[model samples]
Target: MDLALKKQILQKAQDWFVESIAQNHIKNTEKLIKPTEFKINPFTAVYLANFLTGNSNPESIAKALVYPRVLGTSITTSFGTNIQKFTSEVLSAFGSTTSGIDIEFIDQLDGFKKYCQMKSGPETINKDDVETIAKHFSGVLNLAKTNSLRIAHSDMIVGVLYGDSGDLNAHYKRITSEYHFPVYDLSPELVPFS
Candidate 1:
């Protein structure tokens, strides 16, 4: 990435992270929810039981604080997902095609145009999601193929926003096994998947 673009991305990231956390906190606590009103089991409660210790009162207070915005206000929402998606907007500022790919940028080293499907992290996907991602990447490749655009697989990527090589889950392994391109990790390299 160029310096100006990098700076812009950093600023965007800061805005996404800081502002969204504040927003999530606001949305979650929009009403004064008491501990008594907090629902213990969400429909998938049986599955989530393993993670819970049956410690209610104190823990329920924590749960009640976030019950209003359960899915919308997680770590994934605050950090990488929006930021990665935000790159599409940033890339549009350049004369780049913002289609099929979440991020498209000219490689600073090789001067080749690199394509990416930005993911929050390695843990972001499931078995079905792996196939969906392959289809997404395939759509990009086949689109290029039909137009006679010589886009190399080496230039295509599943960019994970954080974590190291070790943090990569089975879902990521499954992607690499099939696609055989980059599953870039931002912590060690430059990708996000979870």
Candidate 2:
């Protein structure tokens, strides 16, 4: 990947983290928590909805919500779990129902199948692929889904920032090594705070 492209993607990922934290804080406020309706960026909404509703088929939803920089490529299973947990925490903080927030990959695939079938697209997902992806992410997803209710809702900002930082560090290391470039520290100056 071009250095500029990589930097841009990294920045976008960071921005999401900041936004997630902000949203988390807003949800935590007692006044905001009781509101029945709210708005989120369309992309965030998709992930939030999936986590809250536990939609199994996320391909279409993913397609709709995935920031282009993170699309198509395989993400470590841990990232998936983090996202599920993050979504659940955010919803819970806002006093939204989380009955469907469990991150069962099989269920997500089932939903993806239904979505793909309805959209007049080739069925690009297969059981093997789902299993492979799920295997990669199962640990994180399982932990997040199972322990979601136990997480302190007040930690949303810290949790999201920590998760995003880890992922960005990993991505930076991967790209630097892949391109044989000297790894530069991701100084705060290089990334936007918001």
Candidate 3:
């Protein structure tokens, strides 16, 4: 990525991390949640990135106090999921028009609009997960036909980004080989799957 674009992504991701911490709320406080060994908070990820890129700022550390761990593992996991999805959506805007099954830009450069399913890492997927994904695609296909949207079967792709480094690349390759859909590993250059 270009320097300007990379900087923009980092800034936006950090902003998102702060906002997420401030607004975090659990619907069910009654439910017990045990803290896990994993420290997967987005703020932590952002801090790591900032450290690696030599972009450290006091604001990043000051906001760390608000990093919600009240719900422990549940809160951390939820925040991680939110940030990953948010980052992926923002990144997608740099190139493609990411959307649901509502419409399709048929005459675009790629000839057809793409529907992407993004994953944070090379985490294991079960058979049921695969089946559920297939069902989701089938639903979207049906929805597209019902709405008279122009799309092609070949426009669908599975995108894997930010994963655990040791296994991230391997996971990406495994996922791509396991499924028929084309997969793109868009993990940042410095951190493959942080």
On TM-score, the leading prediction is 1
lDDT of 3 at 88: 44
Runs in model 1 lying further than 4 Å from the true structure? 1-12, 31-75, 78-81, 85-100, 187-194
List clashing residue pairs in candidate 2: 56-107, 56-108, 57-108, 57-111, 57-112, 77-137
- Residue runs of model 2 more than 4 Å from their true location after superposition: 30-194
lDDT of 2 by residue, 54-132 (tens): 6626554443344332322223222443454443343222222222223211112122200000000112223343333
Q: Give me candidate 2's TM-score against the actual structure.
A: 0.20
**Per-residue lDDT of 20-67 in model 3, one digit per residue for the tens?**
643554443323232342345667756854664555465543333233
- The CA-based lDDT of model 2 is what? 0.33
Off by over 4 Å in 3: 22-72, 92-112, 142-149, 164-175, 186-194
Better of 1 and 2 by TM-score: 1
Model 3: how far is 165 from its true place, Å? 9.2
The stretch of ten residues in a row with the least summed lDDT in candidate 2 is 113-122
Least accurate stretch of 10 residues (summed lDDT) in model 3?
Answer: 99-108
TM-score of each: 0.64, 0.20, 0.50
Q: What is the C-alpha RMSD of each candidate to the true structure, in Å?
A: 5.6, 22.4, 11.8
Q: Candidate 1 residues 1-194, lDDT tens each?
A: 56776787777667755666557656655553564545555544433332354544555535444543464445445555455545554333132364646667676557788787666765876888778777877877888899999888777777676666787888888888876767876432244343
lDDT for 177 in candidate 3 is 57
Worst 10 residues of 1 by lDDT: 87-96
